[model samples]
Target: MNRRNFLLSTAALALSGCTTASLLKKSTEDTIDYQREKVSGFFASVDGKKLVVLGADYHYVMDQIGDLPQVLQSPLKPRLNAEFSYFDLDHDNHVSGQVTLQLKGKVSDAERQKLQMEGFECKGFQEEVWTKVYKVRGTRYLAKGFELPASVSKFNHDYEIIVRESHSPGVKRAMVLLTPVTLAMDGVLVLGGIVLAPVALIVLSNTHWR
Candidate 1:
């Protein structure tokens, strides 16, 4: 191989090996702290079948609805309608891990008790109203009062059972597991290319030298 090609191939092989090792290590790590993913969306159902509908242009989180079909088919369905307003505590414009989930609907005493057991508080009869003000060009505008239920639980976003009503645990795990494998495979291909490139170059050099 030419000196340049040999060096490049060696670098590629080293990089690929490093990448694969890192991915495998990350996959096995048990101490990874996944920050909360903030999302604004509707967690609703049709005829008792539930689904999570995220706001347009927002990213869908695997931890949120990765295994949607399974959750829909599971026996643990909540009778209460869920309104989730996820606020970005870090203002990163990405995933918001802090969430204000408000549940509203008629519930049986048993259901209420179940929710209570799960750390939901019963704040009887609540409503929320807020006015949004903005300016466009030289004109100022007021987006008049919008309303929401005052009953809310501010919690660090984890895959809660209530949120699980529209999520699948299996899918999230699969997605996470597949990513590193795919990357490793790509790295292997690059390493293979690195090996082949040098051999081809070496053959070409020998033929020309002869």
Candidate 2:
């Protein structure tokens, strides 16, 4: 090949490789953004009886991410050492229970008024299960109780407790709309990884690139 032509061909190949690499990097970043926004947090039940939740744990299926951030603080922090109980309310094979919540934090008078204006009344009582959602001193607390029907209790059926919150002063509200259901831990792990994988990859890639 002539010197001029050879140099031109080599330059073209380099340009092509650079374009491909740029496109790949862009694609990866886009995937990461989608996964980040798709993070939907949930509380999963473990052992079909009690819920072991690190509140605000997010999961995604595309990138395998989990436990993004609890973000429980800032006017509403999670109450540590929370406990729940279940009891049989009726003798007719039905169960019921009550939930009590204790929270510690600070709330402004305006926010307190806003919370009341928002009509944040907690309601989730059935069989022997009860859930009380409330805010006190800028801390949010969800106390849940579960009781199984006599027939179901025999087999120790699993249960999940979902909590929802709302505020009038434009605070981000948290809610659990789906009916409590059983989910495999393996599925949860996989979904969590999908959500967090992009962030992890970006961090690692940037480190290596630098």
| lDDT (Cα, tens digit) per residue for candidate 2, span 83-179 | 2222211112122222333233444666445334433333333322212232111112222332222221121222232322212233334542222
* Model 1 spans > 4 angstroms off: 1-58, 62-78, 86-94, 125-210
TM per model?
0.25, 0.24
List clashing residue pairs in candidate 1. Answer: 38-95, 38-96, 67-168
User: Which candidate number has the best TM-score?
Assistant: 1
What C-alpha lDDT values do all the predictions have?
0.30, 0.28
For residue 164, model 1's alpha carbon misses the true position, in angstroms, by 25
RMSD of every prediction: 26.5, 21.3
Q: lDDT tens string, model 1, 1-210? A: 999999999999999999999987766463333233332323322222223323222222222323332332333233322223322221122222222223455666665565555445656555321111111111011112311122322233322211111222233321211111011232321111221010000001111110
